[model samples]
Target: MRERAVQRQDRLLSLVRRRGSARVTDLADQLGVSPVTVRRDVEALTGRGLLDRVHGSVSWPRRRDRPGGGRGPDAEDLVLGLLAPSATYYFADVIRGAHEAAAPAGARLVLRICDYRPAEDPARAAGLLAAGAEGLLVAPGWRGPGDQAAYSDWIAELPVPVVLLERSVPPGGPLAGLDRVCSDHTHGVLLALRHLTGQGHAAPLLVARADSPTALAVREGYAAALRALGVRGPRPVIGSVPADRDPEGFERAVQELRSAVSSGAATAALVHNDVDAIRMVQRLAELGVRVPRDLALVAYDDEVAALADTPLTAVAPPKREVGRQAARLLLERLRERAEGAGGGGTDRGMGGGAGVVPAAGAGSVPDADPAAEPAPRRHVTLLPTLRVRASCGAGAGTGGGATG
Candidate 1:
């Protein structure tokens, strides 16, 4: 219901912005809502200065370009475009963080949702550009390596500055030199393993999917993290699908973990995403196996981990911070371009904001040279921390640190 309300309000704002002003009755009819509801929404928007409520109508405030306008007094009106796969679930917080950062900067964030239409991404970005977007923050839905290869060329050729949000390209790819902000999944896997190992459990088995980039990262990171921790055991990783999409595949994953636990071959496990983890715990419970008793468990993504019956101790990637930093970087790039200085600087390592180190293997941050002017591109990596809970035999404790 809350999501629906947000969508409706977004539509209302877009309509008023495009039309300049709209009668309350007309807005109600166009939005498929009652006049009372439209007036209530208008009142809320007016309070925020997003709309000016006149007699029986609402207008996009004219003072938008002046001091004490809807924007900050010292800020120039900046328009940014955000293109993402979906607005709900994990991307919801990402979008919220971008908005929170953009508001104080007096920037208007325009969003484009591309669902089940990977081929339309370039076209959608063009539309955002045509709508007067000065820059773009894009999260392309690249299902595999092939998808990246197919989309990287045009994405690199976009006219405005672009920031890859929670996405990265392989080193030497067309967009490899572009600015990107992503959570270091390798560090996230390390935190999950260290926490489980500190609790006297051997290397936990991994159950993850290969359909998405983050899933692939978790699967590969699990092995690397295990080796780094110097904990050696039967390190078997299984595959899983969304519980609703492929029940049989999910059941096979659960049975694999069950076999490992029942035979005392494994004592702890990590699941890629929270939804799959929660469903696994529920199914395991029905089979007479309990979390933190029969098998200690950790889940990744931390999206809804805490809501599980036995709250899950999960690795929470710095998702919101990634969005914030990515937007800030793009804004900075735009400011530099506006100031007549080309986008180049003394290897401004990630330290300018958060403890963002350059992402290893994804791309290289050029070494600072005293003779040369400065290096322009940056690939920032944020670290994820572990949230302890009942599922991992820890009682509501924050156990992991950001530093690896």
Candidate 2:
């Protein structure tokens, strides 16, 4: 029965390729089966990457030239584009999430690193789309008004959906309608602050890249915690480090912190993200500063920080979950398109062809809508609990020296 069903689906697809569209009733009559059977066949075939059903109609899948000069079916072949600035452990995890999502759906994932040049993104996006990418996952290197405009334009022109990971865009931007998934930095920061304060430390320094939304949120969370404790003298000294120029940039940050410590400005320091946090700890150690005694430290993104010598007390986000969600959403969109083509009575069995329209669904897929505004005074902040490791004093409950 399964073999016969497969044969029937193949025949229907062949007809769709030739006729450009196939009606469900026509397909049922020709196959000598009920329309219900045809529909089920079409759905199964669609899931298998053989056909696309659109708005009560079916059409043959489009064919595109393969890179090696042979023609290939477009329905089963898809390009999933990924954009990032530089290769880091953090970005790598995000990419892994996206790939895990795309693999089961029979889509190919392509990666292009922008190297911090936001200007180059649009051209890269266009080239990928031209190569037949069905969707995109972008991790913008930096944020600015002009960069936002370019990203918006690129998204508007793409033939499929674009999912932004770990970055926020401007309000009323072109990509505003699209989906986004980001770490709940505000809540993560609060958790870090509470951990430090609970350790009986006050006047900790908050270090980050200046003016970034994530940095700002961390600073705000720290300030709120400080205020709640009624500790007032001078504000927690917030400093910015550059993500583009590392080593030297980090060295400069170390010097600044040394100066702060000398002047009695800050005792403990909270590094913005894990990357910087790890670097900060290393640099401080090189300068003969002991962690948790001379300067207690906490960082964000526990995954990356765990790789450090101290195994940092950092915030962990639902990273793999984010990737799985995005992948599921894109697959849903593809499936919807398939169903629409099948029901239309057009060519249900063939790949891409004329008379097939893409289908859009409400943001029902997991993490499909990243920009859905949070409720008033309430944010969907993923909590980052203290990992209680050797890096912070919580490990052995000792207020002095590093733990083993």
TM-score of each: 0.75, 0.63
lDDT (0 to 1) per candidate: 0.77, 0.60
Report the lDDT tens digits of candidate 1 across residue range 207-318: 8988777887898898899999998847568889988999999999999888888999999999989999999999999888899889989999999999999999888988
* TM-score between candidate 2 and the true structure: 0.63
lDDT of 2: 0.60
Clashing pairs counted in every model = 0, 29
RMSD of 1: 7.8
Q: Where does model 1 exceed 4 Å of error?
A: 1-76, 343-375, 395-404
**Residues 174-247 of candidate 2: C-alpha lDDT, one tens digit per residue:** 54444566666656666666666667777567777654445555665666756655656355455657545666
